[model samples]
Target: MSVRESTFPGVGALRQTGRLFALAASVVRLTFKRPFQKREFVEQFWFIASVTILPTALVSIPFGAVIALQVGSLTKQLGAQSFTGGASVLAVIQQASPLIVALLISGAGGSAICADIGSRTIREEMDAMEVMGVSPVQRLIVPRVLAAMLVAVLLNGLVSVVGVLGGYFFNVIMQGGTPGAYLASFSALAQLPDLYISELKALIFGFIAGVVAAYRGLNPGKGPKGVGDAVNQSVVITFLLLFFVNLVLTAIYLQIVPAKGS
Candidate 1:
């Protein structure tokens, strides 16, 4: 392919990125303007939470169990089996919780948001609202964004707890590790800061997923096919952005929060 052809895609991506950022800023700005949509926010929160809770719990348990199994085996090899709980807890809290929440947000919540908005766009509801002098960003997007952020933080905590418990069960019952040792060592390498960082990561991830979904949905090209494509793009774009954000956040957290006993 010609250099120009390759460059065109990059240029278009950059433009899209800029538009998403601008839309996010607009949502944030409009969120605090008077006459907040309390009903819409509450409804969105319930919708997102109801859809995500079961899936998040199911995913969290397996994730925790897998981590426990792997960490337990490695620790045994290193003669550090007693520290299994500590390692598992740290992994679940610092890494797994935020990542899982992000994936769920994108896979479940993001797609739903995209499809809902896309349908409204295809039906010309958005245009009707605009013609009526209503700001769809403030009325529709802000509530979803705020709800995602709130639910994500709560879901992160739930995932962390479930993951740790799953790890405990796996390590003690499945792997023949001592239950007392596993419980005792859990806090040995964890601290308050880890929980704080995990919540923060979830909040950021939720906001990004919500914003990206909203942007894609709001700007769908033209028809039923456009709605389907927008939903697909929203999930893909949210995942890509979330992974990059997670990497950067993880690095920053590690640099700022010294490990326990370090």
Candidate 2:
């Protein structure tokens, strides 16, 4: 190998990336070839939702309020204060809501998945499953990943509605914005695709989170400490991937979908 390729750091990261992609690919293939695990999927869906719903709702209120306050301030200065609703709504629905779901899912739900799987790995439950001729990826990983995707998509809508209402509440009560103007601005500037992209982002982010967590869980380093470390790594890696993917998706969407007036 060349000097840089021979280096431990570069090789380690590159190998890990390759393995993650491989696991993701296996997941996609297995997802289609399934005697689908409906019960496990339902259990995982509820578990993820229970952990994420309250936090997503709470964080969104402040997130929406902040976006409204910032946009409201800028619009006031530009003498287009009535457009605050449109601007803030676009910001929350198109960007903030999905990001909120991604962050929370990775932080709470993803970590939990990682830790759960990691714990099982260290305990040899995964090995036991393999010995019994059960494919752990199909038995465990696929359902969790699908559940995460579904939950993320549903919660994206929840966050969108809650965020918009929160923004509306703060804008009207604190910023002296009229409800009619706020609602009208949304109608004027926002369109259906904004919501579409937000939900799509959520779906992809969930898939990323679930696959990363399951991958780490499946290949935890060594022992209890290793499992703990893997859990942390999974969360951090998923977060980084989420933002990078979000950037790419946003760029692609912008290119493909013309803005409201343009």
Candidate 3:
């Protein structure tokens, strides 16, 4: 009788596990590092905001208008057209703002971050940093992750306010609802909890997206093909994870929060 010993069950499994742990450790340590470099953070912040803003604004404004139009038309048919304002406010604050921001960020900043790090990896820049006694995790990943989280929160807030206002203008001024009435409905519908949830979602999403993308990008195989594969994988994984997180958060919030007027 003879027995064959398996080589740890799979090819590269040990290396993959080690890298995974390294990435997790990087995230934890970076989170605790004090006196974070403001310059590095600001540079990443600028790049992310600039890359994401245009597409976000474009999508959100039109989404707001479409929501307004649909709700207005439906309510008009039911002789409750004024309620359109409320619907627009609720939709934008609770769902549209966060979702739209995530989409834009995933498309623009996510890919860019992944590509930047992947290119550096391919060029041995990360290795260079390691050789020079510099921690790439501290110098590169930390600042960008923190910046992405902050940017996501700020961008979502801006998107919520702008989208709601855009919807109001379209529904009230252009579509003939009274401005006073629309504002009143908007105020009633946009509760503090809704805005809080949206911002929280954005913060979580940004952190997850940044970290996941960074991990994939920084560990890609050696060369141009590897870089492209990393970028594509980053985008897909980020989007899927973002959606999954959104669902989980939504469920938790629904269960924990008291119902309106309850």
Which ranges of candidate 1 are over 4 A from the true structure? 1-11
Model 1 C-alpha lDDT per residue in residues 182-202, reported as the tens digit of each score: 977886878999999999999
Worst 10 residues of 2 by lDDT: 1-10
Root-mean-square deviation (CA) per prediction: 4.6, 3.9, 5.7
Local accuracy by lDDT, each model? 0.88, 0.88, 0.78
Candidate 3 residue runs with Cα over 4 Å from true position = 1-25, 173-175
Candidate 1, residue 129: the lDDT equals 84
Model 1, C-alpha of 198: deviation from truth (Å): 0.5
lDDT of 2 by residue, 48-135 (tens): 9999999999999999999999999899999999899999999999899999998899888899998998888778787788889888
Candidate 3 global CA lDDT score: 0.78
